[model samples]
Target: MKPGTLHLIPSPIGSNTDVLAPYIRSILESVPYIIAENEKTVRRFLATQMSSELLAAKQFAILDEHTPFQDMPALLDPILAGQDGAIISEAGLPCVADPGSALVQLAHSHHIPVMPHPGPSAIFQTLMASGLNGQRFMFEGYLPIQEQERLARLRFLESLSSREQMSILWIETPYRVKSLFASLCRALREDTSLTIGQALMTEESFIYTATVGDWKKGAIELKKSPAVFAIQALPVAAGLRSNKSGGKAVGKPKK
Candidate 1:
């Protein structure tokens, strides 16, 4: 028999209401308990679509980084008693460097079903459009909040790009994009390749992927852009373990 269910529903990246009507119907009809990062924010965002009354009647609980682990039992008992719970982060997939992991771990240990409802994900989209080597890429989640730690992280990622021959995805808080980009240039090799994806799927947003040397000389700047950066570990090559290196890469130029 399947264990009591837990769902990881994908909310929109930056906007709420992007989930299609069929998806809304499916979630509303299926979920008995809703675990959200911010209930009021979600309520307002969903109100324009799902309406106020129904969303209210369906109770939601707050579960973020601060929620005590001991308190999880209280939340878990109700869920495991056959209440199918849905966890929605503010944006994108839960537990992708987000706060949904502890609850997920609790659910898995208790033999609960942890299902990921597939939908929009920016990281994959960035990699796909990046024109960078995607097969051996690593998503490092986000850059650090502290300057010292953030610089350290950047250096580490740059080393990963040089030593591993694997692409690395770098993310940052929206406000600090310029600082991060500046720091990235300092850390990476002039010829090291980088891909920048900003405000994906939106008319105002764009992506620019290229090498660091060209990036410094390019007209495009990510200073004001909300972006996800994917850095090519090494020049693109056919075989992963093969010692061959320095094959000239072919990719679309960024505008």
Candidate 2:
């Protein structure tokens, strides 16, 4: 029997299901099996796009961060046996920042054809509106939670951005949004440009770009919401100069 294909389905990041492509329903309806980050959440989302009977009839298997590597290959047995399957992320595109990548890799090893359906991604959405260097940017994902390590990583990223004139992007959990913003204000150069994309694609979405110095002048409550942060350091020749204290290039001007 011919090996079945694997479909990569992107889920909406927010309450709006309209962001999903119109062709997604047909893909969802055709797949007999699904691998998802969270079974409950996937079922909840499918309820919006599929009939109650159809949703109940679909078979689901979990493949999240906690899934052991040994157990992953079993998730593909049905597909390998000629039954088409789909992978759904908890939010946004599958396998970008999600754990679905492991299974996708396994599918590739077995020569299973993989098809990805385009949909909303918070990372690109933020970069598009950031007004930063769209030509060159890197997504750093999540920073270290330890204060000192996180600070060191921030400074290193800033230095790299300064030298290369590239943008750096990362994300934080909802509860840590304000805390991370505060840390960015303190750890980065005052002249560095920062962009905040909060609660994107939702009713409460807020996106703003400003220098670190400008952001420090006012206070805004970020509350607990998903946010993407981007930073572009001022070019070395623009204003950055060698620091006398640390012997490193400093982007902030002496106050």
Candidate 3:
């Protein structure tokens, strides 16, 4: 029997399922075994995308941060037996800032064919709108929650971005959005370019790019919103500051 292919399926970032290519449905229909970060969400997505019948018929194995190393090896058993399988995340593409990568790595080691289907990704959507250097950017995922470690990481990434002229992309849970934004405003240079993409693709979606100093001046509320943040390093002088409406700081173009 021919080896079964491993499909890397992408889940919806927001309520918009239109981002998925038409071919994705066919791919989803082809596989019966799925490895997902959240089985419930994946199943629900399948039901919405195709049919409730598909959801009922499919088999799932959970693969998240809590999934054990020992359990991973067994998860590959179905694929090794020439059964087509898939990996999905709670949101966005699989294996990205998600534990699904381990399954992909294992699939590669066994020479199982791994195929990717294009779909919605919050990281790319944020970068596309960031107005930053999209050509070169880094996805740092989530920063450490610990204040000291998080501050050190912020400075390190900032220096790297400044030196490399690359955009730094990261995210935070809905509840911590405000805290993380506050931290960025404090730790990053005043002139650093920052883009905040909140509630992307949803009715409440918000995307704004401005200098750190500019962001500090505005009373933007990002609490309880899923968001992606992108920062572009700028020479302190080149990244000048401007005032918003009422003497509030705003990002000025790099000279």
- lDDT to native, each model: 0.72, 0.86, 0.82
Instruction: Point out where model 1 deviates above 4 Å.
Output: 1-3, 16-24, 48-51, 146-148, 223-225, 235-255
Q: Give the alpha carbon lDDT tens digit for every residue of 1-255 in model 1.
A: 344688887666656456543665567555768888888865665565565566767768888889988887667776777778888777667777567798899898898978888766778888888877777889887788777888788777867666778788967677888888787777766556778888876666677776666676666646465678888755324323323443333343454
lDDT of 2 by residue, 1-255 (tens): 788999999999888998888889988987889898899999999999989999888999999999999999999999999999999999998998788888899899999999999998898999999889999999999999888888889999999999999999998999888778878887998778888888888888888887787677656667598889999997776635523232232122222
Q: What is the lDDT of candidate 1?
A: 0.72
Q: Which of the predicted structures, 1 or 3, would earn the higher lDDT when compared with the native?
A: 3
**Candidate topping lDDT:** 2
Candidate 2 collision pairs: none
**Candidate 2 worst ten-residue window by lDDT:** 246-255
Q: Pick the candidate with the highest TM-score.
A: 2
- So what's the TM-score on candidate 1? 0.83
Best-to-worst TM-score order = 2, 3, 1
lDDT of 1 at 84: 82
How many steric overlaps are in each model, in order? Answer: 0, 0, 0
Tell me each candidate's RMSD, in Å, in order.
4.3, 4.3, 3.9
